[model samples]
Target: MIPLKDNIPSRRFPLVTLTLIIINTLVWLFERSLGPSMENLIFAFGVTPADLFQYGLVSQLFFMTTAMFMHGGWMHFLGNMLYLWIFGDNVEDRMGKFRFLIFYLITGYIATLAHVLSDPTSTSPLIGASGAIAGVLGGYFVLFPHAKVLTLIPIFIFIQIIHIPALYFLGFWFLLQIFNQTFQGAQSVAFLAHIGGFAAGALLVKFFQKYRY
Candidate 1:
């Protein structure tokens, strides 16, 4: 299911969300410019679970944060940005700019750590914003459970558009991650990171919102 938009409107400008999107876009463009050297960039900046454990806290922090802004391909980049554009605004609106920014980074870090812990021996470099965007999805799930999301469901040859509640939509998404991780066993995507990020966001959103806006 692809989420096109949501029913809940943001009361405040989603400056942080927009800025994050811009930064990710620019970083992706830079990655494209790297051409043949893009592999080098991914190794340098992306989080490799085994290598991540061998690094110092500073270097580990560097990889965890930098990885979120990078993408593996056009599909990866566009999919993440679409979800962020659809769901991130309301989350940013609820948490305010600074808190939301902090929340995003923290959840992303936690997501990376979750992936590391899941398979510390694996050597693949994890990239993209799906994990962090998963956090935003989790926050949206908690903050706006009743909100409706206009989703695109492709049923083989036909496409169906339906309004799904945030609760069911995100719940299914989280479950799908688990299902993929359990059965698929880590193909290219880091399902554990998505799971961890979503869990982190759901657990942390209330605490982040407790502070004065």
Candidate 2:
């Protein structure tokens, strides 16, 4: 099921979330402008466990933070932005602007660390905001478990729209990430990062959020 939107409306404008999306979009555009240099950029900005360990502390921190804003392709960027657009606003609303922004970066760092720990020797550059968005999902899951999400589910030739509770939707998503990471092993996608982000989000949201239940 693909979530289109959620029932919980933001009490205030999601400044941080919108800003992040704009930044991601602008960065993606700049990356495309690089053409041949894009690969080098991703490698330089992206997080690789080997590179993180090899680099100095400052460089490692740079990669960890910048990696969240980079994406591999249009679909990658759109998919991550879509989730952030939907779930992020409500989370931002609950956590307050400044706290939500910091929370996002921290969870993203945690997510990257999770990936690095899972495959310390892998040299592949891990790009995209999937892990960070997964963190948003985690926090949203905690703060808005009962919120309804309008989702699109494709069945063969037909498309069905379903209203799903955040609990079940996020729960299934987290489980799927874990399952894929366990079964798929090493692949292009960082399933471990997603799981890590989601887990971190769920746990961190409690401390970050102002409202309860």
Candidate 3:
């Protein structure tokens, strides 16, 4: 399901969310400009669990954060940023800009660790903001369960845009992550990371909630 928008409105400008989207776009542009050097860049910046064994502490830690800002392809980038655009604004609003930024980075790190725990020896490079955005969705689920998400769900020949409660939308999303992780056995997508990030955001949202405007 593609979320077109949410019913909830932000009281303040979503500076953080807009900033994130812009940063991601700029990073994507830089990655594209790399041309043949793209593979090298992704390897250097993207999180590889095996790198933990090879690189120094600082470098390994840096990879975890850098991986979130990188993307493997245009579709991968768009899907992640779309989720962030739909849900991140309200999350930023609730947590406030400074706190929300902290929450986002921490949850993303947790998400990366989750993938690492899944297979610590794997050399595959994990990249993209889906895991971090999954954290945002988890927080949204906790904070606005009843809010309606206008989703574009395709069925047969017709694509339908329907309003789904945030609880169900996010619940089903989390479930899909688990389901794929359990049965699919990790093809290309990082299911474990999504599961971990979602759990972190859902559990941590209450503590992070602050009215700073």
Poorly placed runs, candidate 1 (over 4 Å): 210-213
lDDT of 1 by residue, 154-178 (tens): 9999999999999999999999999
**Which sections of candidate 2 miss by over 4 Å?**
55-59, 211-213
Alpha-carbon RMSD, candidate 3: 1.7
C-alpha local distance difference test of each model: 0.91, 0.89, 0.91
Q: Which ten residues in a row have the lowest lDDT in candidate 1?
A: 204-213
Evaluate model 3: give its TM-score.
Answer: 0.95
lDDT of 2 by residue, 40-104 (tens): 99988888888876774467888888899999999888889999999999999988999898889
Residue pairs in collision within model 1: none
Candidate 3: the clashing residue pairs are: none
